[model samples]
Target: EMALASDIGVMVTTDPSQAYAEPLHAWLFGEDQGRYLIAVPEGGVDPILRAAAGTGVPVRRIGTTGGAVITVNGQGAVSVAELKALHENWLPVYMA
Candidate 1:
């Protein structure tokens, strides 16, 4: 939810399930080494992509940023307010 805290939302257009050739769950939750999600500003991603390509690093444009809700491929969207409430209340609720 860092993007939400940064006053922006993420629209993940690419299906994360297609990230690997098999066992989608493994790719989704497994701690695959050296993989990273980098956020680049508009019009600035080209340089990053080019640099990664030069170094033989795999880079893909998965999403963009905006709005008040974080959604993936127009599916489930959880509002920032909901996420903040859950984060802020987790400790208190658990203590109770």
Candidate 2:
């Protein structure tokens, strides 16, 4: 439904664990054949922000192809440098 209607799909869920799963499924269905983007809020423990820290249930392992870009934000502002560094260092390795 969403894939048929939009050129891109943005899934914002409170549960980070579920975020990637659906995207991956959509990709399998050919809905995300190089036409979709999945973004998630930083998953960490911040008492005031109601974020989760570390790992537990609802968290699952998934492999990235490395070219995918990830962005991190704090209080609605992106941490540009940090995200860049992360992409540079991690993205290639994951994709390779």
Candidate 3:
């Protein structure tokens, strides 16, 4: 729900294959520790890269943000409005 919380769209261009030499079973359903996705403002990523490099922390640009639809590899995953509705309606439904 990053898009919903940040009020921006996100497109995931990279997949598990990029980071893993072999296929990861259930990668979509599994959590890898210390992995993170961050949004950097346009034209502001160089510093972050430099810092990461200096600290020996691997980082890469994986996505871009804007628009209203969340997409992965150019395929629309979901819209912010739909997710927001789900988030807002979940509690009431659960309570009932």
Candidate 4:
């Protein structure tokens, strides 16, 4: 849990960011956890393209840091309860 574990910025997603990784993170951590950068799909790379271009690394701008909240595509804010439901539904493979 970055909220209690670290005192630095953490990269939140990877281009070709796999499956539920991005969604679960944005919902669980949000800005309240720390300053974070989420990688988006191909169309969302302009913000970090120049900065990361020469490094041979790809980056993108997906979510923005605002308040203590979880937002997906600037529309859905995954509530704590919703996050719990998500885990209950999706992560059952791990629980058993």
| Cα TM-score per model | 0.78, 0.19, 0.74, 0.33
lDDT of 1 by residue, 1-96 (tens): 566478677787766555466564455345668877778789999999899899998888878888888877788897867787788899999999
- In order, candidate lDDTs are 0.76, 0.35, 0.77, 0.47
lDDT of 2 by residue, 1-96 (tens): 322233222222233444445553353345533344333334432431332223332332222212222222112333334455565679787888
Hey, what RMSD does candidate 1 come out at? 2.7
Give the alpha carbon lDDT tens digit for every residue of 1-96 in model 3. Answer: 578897777777766557664354444334579877677788878998899999999988777899887887787678878888898899999999
Query: RMSD for each model, in Å, please?
Result: 2.7, 14.8, 3.1, 10.9
- Where in model 3 is the C-alpha error above 4 Å? 15-32
lDDT score for candidate 1 against the true structure: 0.76
What order do candidates take by lDDT, descending?
A: 3, 1, 4, 2
Per TM-score, the best of the predicted structures is 1
| Prediction 4 global C-alpha lDDT | 0.47
Residues 1-96, model 4: lDDT tens digits: 331122222232333444544566564456754345543445555746776787767544544333333545454554544454565577676666
What C-alpha lDDT does candidate 3 achieve relative to the native structure?
Answer: 0.77
Which prediction has the highest lDDT against the true structure?
3
Cα lDDT of candidate 2 equals: 0.35
Can you rank all candidates by TM-score, best first?
Answer: 1, 3, 4, 2
Question: Model 1, which residues run further than 4 Å from truth?
Answer: 15-31
Worst 10 residues of 1 by lDDT: 21-30
